[model samples]
Target: MMRHPFVLFALGTFAVFLLLHLAGGRQYVGVLSGTVVGGAGGAGLGLLYALAWFGAVLAAPVLLLAGLLDGALARASRARP
Candidate 1:
């Protein structure tokens, strides 16, 4: 089966969430507590937050580098005979 990067990212994010829930109970509780006071809603809200955080933390850097590499390659190709 072919697994896309988004699928992998989501699965990895959920796995990290589960691991943290199990191992970093206190820290997770603190985060949840803050979110609760800030009026964060159900699992959907949490998932959205997780996805956004993962995108910012992980995906953004990779995307930025890909863009930079693409630009550099294009510039190099244009400069070729």
Candidate 2:
């Protein structure tokens, strides 16, 4: 699983999202609703947090599926001969 590039990428994406969320990153996400929680410096951080959330929500599952498929195919091919 971890040997596959897609899997590793998905894991990395999820890890980043988790870390940010744990570090009170969600406060920044309020920016999306025009709430701006942390002031001037927080805008960029908010954008980053939003992007990370999107990536975790949208890209991570696809990546994990791709990785699983790739790993299965590799194993099947190796076992054939």
* TM-scores for all predictions: 0.47, 0.89
| Every candidate's lDDT | 0.53, 0.86
TM-score of 1: 0.47
The residue ranges of model 2 lying beyond 4 angstroms of the native Cα positions read none
The Cα error of candidate 1 at residue 3, in Å, is: 27
Candidate 1 wrongly placed segments (more than 4 Å): 1-40
Question: Residue-wise lDDT of candidate 1 within 1-81, one digit each (tens)?
Answer: 314454455556656655545543323233444554223334445555555556556875575556566667777999999
Please give the lDDT score at residue 58 for candidate 2: 100
CA shift at 10, candidate 1, in angstroms? 16
lDDT of 2 by residue, 1-81 (tens): 258989999999999989888877878877888888779768767888789899999999999999999899988999996
Give candidate 2's whole-model lDDT.
0.86
